[model samples]
Target: MKKLLVITCFLLAGMGFANAQQTSPVWPGCEDADDVKKCFNQKLSKHVQQNYVYPKNEAGEYVRGKVTISFQIDENGKVVVNSVEGAKPKVNQAAKEMILKIPEMEPGTLNGEPDARNFTVPFNF
Candidate 1:
């Protein structure tokens, strides 16, 4: 219970920080010359389909909770798994690993080139 709160707080803080930062328009998962949002969404959907699994607790019980996941799409289009907010360490770790399986995107473009961008996503299971 306590860990969950801490994780939630951290996720909220991270999201708030992201929101405060400059909303630079870079192609999310594709070249800046392309549609940024479209690429990002497509890549993200592919990732979820490939790696996401329903959560399970240590007691072998189905765990129902919302996970806050953070990742970065680098200029080279590699996924950098950052953090996951969950009730238990195992749950959080699982979510992190699952998110890490996200396939590399085409990378974001700032000016017809690659640019780094952070993404915050929530996974509920």
Candidate 2:
């Protein structure tokens, strides 16, 4: 009886997890692609690397640090930068700007309804 109970619990938990998965946001150029999530991630990394600009301090020395930029894709599919953590002011600002440059995407969905989803990107400079 105890074993049956445990198995039932496990099955229930698996069903809950399967239903909890949300639909990922569609990247601008990946709208027609089969795998939106994977394409979005790949494009995001490439975008950050391509647009990254190292910040320079007053003495013209390169700012060396890292920041984790957090943002959300709102219901309208616009990128809204929420916070930047663990970096100098200039570094943080640069990271925010870079993330903001991401083109508008198709908003993520939860249960077939548009929803806001958070994402994080790390920048090392």
Candidate 3:
């Protein structure tokens, strides 16, 4: 009976920890969004589509590659590109430029305090 009581206590404590709330960084127009995360994703996709530029090789052929970009929305609500990786340098540079164009907005929160949020996304060109 003592062991059962201890296990139940532990489980309840774990549940409390699991329920901690964390929020994603809010996009510029997502201040009143019902689902902030979904809104953020939609805004990010739109920004990428609008800002993406295709790179061309010396022969004027379009460069084809995929880039993985890692970035963070800082506690001050600024976009910072952490890294970009791709087969070709041009592709990486293009992806980096696109991510850098993201506008600053309200920072995300962890437990209701401003917190930085990291994101990794892939781009194809």
Candidate 4:
């Protein structure tokens, strides 16, 4: 029975350590949020809406397309655009600009150390 108890204690401690290994990046205002992930998503959507600018063609018509942006928050909490893919160059540029406007926040963690986090977002214009 003593041996079994020792094994169980070790297993519990290992599980706790594993749970602390990874965490999502925290948005500036979400430090006290109940659900950090949801708060992050809300802030991201708001940022996109506020910064998005419609692109226009040379003929003066609005350019419409879907853009997929892949970005990362580095260990220093800086936003870095990895790639922007879209149907039109103007749309891709617009998406990249909007993403680049995101404010720096706390970096995520992996294995209890600051780590980079990647995200992929889609936008339609």
Candidate maximizing lDDT: 4
The TM-score of predicted model 2 comes to: 0.79
Query: Whole-model Cα lDDT per candidate?
Result: 0.70, 0.87, 0.92, 0.93
Q: For model 3, how does the per-residue alpha-carbon lDDT over 1-125 read when each residue is reduced to its tens digit?
A: 99999999999999987987888899999999999999999999999889988889999998879889999999999999999998999889988898999999899988899999999998777
Which candidate has the top score in TM-score? 3
| Ranking according to lDDT, highest score first | 4, 3, 2, 1
lDDT per residue (tens digit) for residues 1-125 in model 2: 99999999999999987897588889978978888888998999899889878889989998878898889999989999988997488888878888889889889988788999998877687
- Please give, for residues 46-71, the per-residue lDDT of candidate 1 as tens digits: 76777766567678886666778888
Model 1, global lDDT: 0.70
- Residue 73 Cα positional deviation in candidate 4, in Å, after optimal superposition: 0.5
Candidate 4 structure quality by residue, lDDT tens digits, 4-48: 999999999999877877889999999999999999999998998
Task: State how far residue 56 of model 1 sits from its true place (Å).
Answer: 3.0
Off by over 4 Å in 4: 1-20
CA RMSD of each candidate after superposition: 12.6, 3.2, 2.7, 5.1
Error of 3 at 109 (Å): 0.3
